[model samples]
Target: MDEQLMLVENLDMCFSTGKGNITALHNLSFDVKKGEFLAIVGPSGCGKSTLINILAGILRPTGGKVVLDGEEVREISPKMGMVFQKYAAFPWMTVRQNISYGPRIARKPKSEIEKITNHYSSMVGLEAYEHLYPKELSGGMSKRVDIARAYANQPEVLLMDEPFGALDDITKKQMQTELLNIWGQENKTVIFITHDLEEAIFLADRILVLRRPKEDQNSLNFIQPVPFSRPREPELRTCGEFVRLKAELSEVMLK
Candidate 1:
């Protein structure tokens, strides 16, 4: 079977500012393999969020194209799901209602929707809170609802933009493990955006490093493959290989 699932070619994004055009991304190109966990890390203002938005079809790029599943993407597709840094749960919807919103929109069978809601709620540890509204949930619990909602949609590729960035250190760590567990079970291709090098190394099969483009030069973006074996434990973060990889990524980020 072919490993590659998505192709990004010569991607570029430029904005019209008062001072003139501001280029957020230039000639960025890469491929995401089927079921691969790909993390994107970069310096601030390096187009990390912009890139994810374009991939999600939330924004249009000035140049280049994204091809997924052998077709060019020009607009939003049900095949792509997104989980943002901020909690995206509907304020008025109960946990069960929120998680099942996507499938319900697609007019899935009532039985299937119920099953999906139950499955992802349990997967994200929200089964106990399924009947509660967003106002009654903690930030962590709300974020769990966001994730479950995304997975419930059953997208071929999941796009995450710093989903745990606002959580406390303990909660962030817990979410990371939970995300990995969900990924293992779902076997979906994931494109995760984060500023945390350790988080990227911990969760990604390969890490893509992006640099801001200069007026006269094209910033070279590169990908680094993570070497750790699957089912990695939290203790792996303290190991020598993990440290070395993190150090290497840090240098890449700075350069």
Candidate 2:
């Protein structure tokens, strides 16, 4: 088994709203292995987005802490990268500029920034569109820019919150394939947030399910493992085993 890369222990989050204190997560704990692709799924109001934000260090939990590679994540760190559901590219910047933004902010050498830009733009098949601004690109192309930018940052882990949730079905499928190809080549640990069970099963090594908190109930539903082999193709979606797993997860999701 891969060594553990992140530890979430006894996490708890509460909000002070106009109504009063409301808990979002309660005593949630899990471990993500190094280079593992872990998908998180749950219905609306289940705190999937909140968990992603906590992992990205964008929010501080009311209790517990996230330990990444042995150190606690107290605030936003350079070691983590995120891709949001909407296209996160800057409208004013061209593809090359957007991809190089992180390295530039870090004050990397000009040559290194240029190299990083070229490599990631090419990786996302955006070399031809490198000079185009986000406004001129298609939705899928814009998303490619977002992915390339996040990867070029060279973060230890990638936290994606429904990055493909806004694309049309066809484009979403294409991006999913491209994402898998990138993951295969890079071997970076990923924590993906999605409501789609099919998408979760298709891309993740393991699925962590959460439930809406009610009263004193915990937020965790269960964690399911994906046993499929790698280099998986779209045809796998039609196979008996894949369909069975999807059905099982659907049952769990609807409960």
Say which candidate scores most in lDDT: 2
TM-scores, all models, native as reference: 0.96, 0.97
The regions of model 2 sitting more than 4 angstroms off are: none
Q: Summarize candidate 1's per-residue lDDT along 1-255 as a digit string, tens digits.
A: 139999999889999999999999998889999999999999998998889888999898999999999988888887999898888999999999999999999999999999989999999989999899999999999999999999999998999999999999999999899999999999999999999999999999999988999866554467888999989899999999899989987987787
Clashes of each: 0, 0
Score candidate 2 by TM-score against the native: 0.97
Model 1 stretches with alpha carbons more than 4 Å out: 215-220
Scored against the true structure, residue 81 in model 1 reaches a CA lDDT of 91
- The positional error of residue 152 in candidate 2, measured at the CA in angstroms, is 0.3
Global fold similarity of model 1 (TM-score): 0.96
